[model samples]
Target: MNYHLFKRAAKLFTSLLGTTLLLSGCQSSPESIVEKITPLNPASDVVPVRVVRIDSSYQLQRAGKPYVIKGAAGVQHFEKIKEKGGNSVRLYAPAYADVLMDKAHQNGLTVMFGLWMKPPYEKFDYYDPKAVAEQQQEVYRQVQRYKNHPALLMWNLGNELDNHYGDFKVYQIVNETVKMIHKLDPNHPVTTTITDGVYAIPSIIHLCPDIDVLTVNVFNKLAQQPVRLAEAGWKGPYIIGEFGGRGWWEAPLTSWEAPLDQSSSDKAEFMQAGFKMTVQDQSSRCLGAYVLYWGNRFEQTDMWLSMFAPTGEKTPMVDMIQTLWTGQKPANQAPQVGAIRVANKLAQADLALEPNTDYPASVPATDPDGDPLRVEWKITRDVDEFHTLPQNRTAPETIPGAIREAKGLNAVIRTPTERGGYRLHVNVYDGQGSVSNNSFPFFVGVLDTPRLGIHMPQYRRY
Candidate 1:
């Protein structure tokens, strides 16, 4: 579990530099911004969902009511998001939009509906008239199918189209599709997402005027957004398309090259700082923010980014989101690993492991709410890459036959044949949907050389 947020503290420096390069100009005064972005629409049975730009500020309104998108990017957990005071969910595709819309509307939440667009790095050619026409037809059909859903807020056109892409024609296609979306669904504004704020360039800003908002999915570089937007010189509104814990791309790597990670609690703490600095800054032009990957999936580690575990249990990151969105923590607290010992030693420097060795470890943990705790252990080889592009997304290689599971609170872990860097990870679940994870990194060295006396051999040489 994440005992603290001290691991990879050096990475925070890089986050600052990234932030400075992205966002620069001071934000407009709240009074001036508020007055500039006030929606012209009066109260009515249904206020059109739209982005209003008064001067330096923009506001999203629905039925003439002010709405800030406390949204998460996930299909599951609509009820949880709403209960946690989030007003929306951002979907990556329309595959389950029909069902999601029905559920989100029932839960008194809106949806930032996403339309999947193929990135140009793939075989799909945006320059081809036939391909573009066929894609536009598909887009039209989907828009026609779901434009009337009450839960629909805005049209998120694509997710990080700039990633691994070289052709600027992609943006041209986006301009075309957004223009089409506006024609078919005027009630909702249209937007597109980039991997980070740095992609919000002047060309994208000027090229797609039909696009209302420049949404960004920022991980550790979140603090750079304001500066990035200012650097882009775009005057339109923006939204945090995806954010939460640090991304696998930017985290520190182990000696063997695996991404060093934060505990669940530490992820929550970094998230708190990120939200406070960017999305929660009311005076800034940020329209709203969406937490990334609401459900669990393997990304570096199972617990690396997902707010929920595979069993639908929430991690401390989830609680942090609840507190940020609702101004209060959840009723249940996650289990905390007070100490993790390898070979009865808590220090990494002291726990020197040898190849083909078996080692004993203990994860002493406690639950704040006194709930029964379940623990799991995992070990993986560290890798050499600190960051990855979209095309290069992958988890570190697992050290096979490495962990021998013990009954409780401990395990007998097997070391790899080759010496390098590896980590012992522990996850503690409180069964109340709260969990904490901790990872202990250790070094593996070669077996010691055998020594023998050579007194007889020296006499023979003479």
Candidate 2:
């Protein structure tokens, strides 16, 4: 009996089990760890940006004017954002603060200026007085630089600092930073975002006295945001810093452990639900909500939660946000691609196809205003930053005439010669800049060999 072999087998089994649990949401790694106020102290004699109770509800006011933050997360499409009834944009960094402010002001929109902070996992130590003092000084400089800009709405101090730090000193630093900002620039309020709605919450509530608003960035549980806040007894005003479609962590998975995604319409429905739960519920503490990844991002999948496609094609979710913001639907609604059928059959999870096989794909689509619909099909590999390993993404693989669009509803797509996962995406456009897309993922080869029990050939009962 070899005890070393048995020990190695046990260690490998435990490691694999932990990884499985992490991926299954039953466990998480260590170190993964809100509101309000008045015109108290009158730090700068005049504070224009404030949260006011308006008819039993709360609204963020800027320059003594009622302001509901119809904000998007990204800053690329200011014109489209304005046209879609968005009045603000949230930035995560100050690199292009000047340019963004100019563009947002031109578009009749305000900006939620995000102040990037060093996470606890980073090089800086919040406990170190010198480091903290330097950060405070830098924050003051940045605030003074942009505080007078008309497009500046409020100061978002740090984004999800709790994710990596469970230390109470981080919030203390945030509190100090807020105090400095109030003294330097009292016109704008200060806020810090959280990934978890309720985390080290007591410390945040008690320690961070100067925080004006408690912003939360949520995903799958976004619809239950209000409930969670209430459960945590968080009475401070809050904004949905970011809420998108289903989060990749909890999304349904295929046999290959890849996350199954929601269709565009389904995503729009989730966004609507999120808005209803957080922003439109008429709660006094609810100010407004911002959709995450307003523009296209390569997170998990290209179509994960972004309102617009990577090619600048607007999805139905855009119209959903516009309607929610304006209380009226867009004049020209986008086409809806309800479902996609591959090879005249509906593949429940993912369609498995033979290499170099020809498969026909079609979508059921309709335009809202009875406009003519044009369906376009494209094929690409399922490799993405979130899902694929870094080593596996060495180079772009050739799809090899993967999809050939037909004249009408159907298109014939050829499977890739390589044995891997691929996707067939369909875009239904109304010829009026409104578009809806659906993607069907397919595997080009057989599943990997199933794992048997852990083998320790040299081990035996002692």
Per TM-score, the best of the predicted structures is 2
Per-residue lDDT of candidate 2, residues 1-462 (tens digit): 599978866755664454445434521211110011122233343336887765655678877887778889986788988898888899988887778878888898888899888777555666455455556555656776677777778999988788646655688668866876787676888999887548656788888978888998887887787888777777778988988777665665454544556678878888898788778874577778787777876655566666787678788889899989888998888887777788886646445779888888888888889989887777777754444442354333436588765755688988888888777777777888777877776778886666222222221101
Task: Report the lDDT of model 2 for residue 122.
Answer: 59
RMSD of each: 14.6, 11.3
lDDT of 2: 0.73
Candidate 1 residue-wise lDDT, 131-220, digit = tens:
655566666667666677777788889888887664455786788678867875678899998877364366686667789888988878
Candidate 1 colliding pairs, count: 19
lDDT (0-100) at residue 323 of candidate 1?
A: 93
- Candidate 1 lDDT for residue 120: 74
Alpha-carbon shift of residue 48 in model 1 (angstroms): 2.4
What stretches of model 2 exceed 4 Å from their correct place?
1-47, 53-58, 121-133, 164-168, 344-347, 387-398, 404-407, 449-462
Clashes within 3 Å, all models in order: 19, 0
The C-alpha stretches of model 1 lying farther than 4 A from their native spots are: 1-47, 337-353, 360-366, 370-372, 380-411, 416-423, 440-462
